[model samples]
Target: MSDGYSLTVELTRGGDSNNRDKMRATVEADTVDELREKVDALRDEMQEWADDFRNIQPEYRRELPDDQSQLGEVQA
Candidate 1:
């Protein structure tokens, strides 16, 4: 077969027949260089999502300690 991918999924119901599906994809690239390009694009998308979580999230702040300093120490 040509350079391609095939995915098959099957689901079965309770006490009944089974359902099957098959998907086939073909890439016209003759070498691995084209495949690497596709992988790089996916990586960039994932990095952008991670940056939003780390930098844009409001919970990523430094809070004061929750010790008794806020209420002042009790005199002996």
Candidate 2:
């Protein structure tokens, strides 16, 4: 018996023309725990892409919380 999952993640470019970014990947594992590990790895990769996008477009970047949460919230 074999257990595995095939998933696709998509992202949209923010600009004049909207373009699609498609990422197709597969995770093969014998157990659920192993599958979770594989999924976490995939999630990390997606997060890196998001970080890169924020870096490229300063206007769409999200503000980070500072030591003074109240002040940061107010500024935002």
Question: What range of 10 consecutive residues in model 2 has the weakest lDDT sum?
Answer: 13-22
Model 1 lDDT at residue 41: 56
Model 1 Cα lDDT, one tens digit per residue, 10-67: 2222342332222223333445676556545545654565455345433455555666
In lDDT terms, how accurate is model 2?
0.61
Quantify all predictions' global Cα lDDT against the true fold: 0.44, 0.61
Candidate 2 residue pairs in clash (backbone atoms < 3 Å): none
Residue-wise C-alpha lDDT for candidate 2, range 20-62, written one tens digit per residue? 3444566666777877888789889877886675566335665
Q: Give per-model TM-scores.
A: 0.32, 0.44
lDDT of 1 at 29: 42
Best by lDDT: 2
Off by over 4 Å in 1: 5-31, 56-76
The alpha-carbon RMSD values of the candidates against the true structure, listed in the order shown, are 15.5, 13.6
For model 2, the stretches where C-alpha displacement exceeds 4 angstroms are 1-18, 50-76
